[model samples]
Target: MSTLSDYLNEHLPDGWQKPQLVEALSGTLDRATVYRYLAGSHPRSPAESVLEAFAKVLPGVTVVELRAAANLSAGAEEPWVPPVEANRLSHAQRRALESFIKATVGPIDDGDEPNHRQPSVDLQPAAPALTEQERAEVESYVQRLYASGRKDLADRVASSLVNNPSIEPATRPADA
Candidate 1:
């Protein structure tokens, strides 16, 4: 299983940030909605309208293909299969799909295991309750206090948890 970032970074061509793509689509969808799709956390199953929009912006992918990619299974509900045959691709669409496959699929190198594992998209490991950015902001505030020679103030700020009353004392590393 790969993270959503991995799939987006590796599979998508350049210039495919969710916001950029959504704006390009113009009122069709929101970027958060797209992230929900990619993160496989959409409330309802992938909608046709959203799928169609993605098909247009993304190269080498159809609505069906995007749906498949979006609903990659990994300890989540299986992807909802399209119900109506009407929504299915036409002959031309199939031909385009074939061409896309031809371009994207090539021989695996010797000892390479193509199709050895199913592909999946997952969120990055659950981040700390406080994110790196949040921690950086806190650290920056502490640094400002230190820079102003407010050592006591900086120590208080550094030791205090913004949300929690009980704070863990900063510990030195074994190497230090």
Candidate 2:
């Protein structure tokens, strides 16, 4: 997926400053508006309407499509430019997006081998290890998730650990 920065830099017309663009959208919108808009806050109501003005300023297409595309692509390490919208996605396009995000942000070494996996995010060096109290708090949170039958969130947590670079992975040899 094109980084949000790329979209802002390339799509916004030349000679118009980002602040100017923000001003055009809403006179009261501040610097943070430009920052968050480019940083990829998904559209909410009036902001959604403003995207149309953006398309006009940029020219040619409907803003809803642009916003939807950006919404799906936000925060991804790669550019996932779908030539068509969700409704128009072919089986192939669907598979590609799923594969892309799963590979980029989902679990590591999930059996698609031969391509070395580098973490999309480089986390800061670890701080001191978790305190016993911190561990207890985390354990309680996990237990609460399980007790509430939020298995999907539990699965996401497990996947995050599997992909995390902070913890060295435990390895086991294959057995006959």
lDDT of each: 0.46, 0.44
Q: Number of the top candidate by TM-score?
A: 1
Clashing pairs in 2: 1-78, 1-79, 1-80, 2-79
Question: lDDT by residue for model 2 over 9-49, one digit each (tens)?
Answer: 55666687777677766654456756676655523322444
lDDT of 1 by residue, 72-146 (tens): 222223444545752665554444334423322222222322122333333112112333444444555555556
Candidate 2 local Cα displacement, residue 149, angstroms: 40
How many angstroms is residue 45 displaced in model 1 relative to the true structure, after the best TM-score fit? 2.4
RMSD of 1: 21.5
Regions of candidate 1 where Cα sits further than 4 Å from its true position: 1-10, 70-176
Angstrom error at residue 93, model 2? 33
For every model in order, what is the number of clashing pairs? Answer: 0, 4
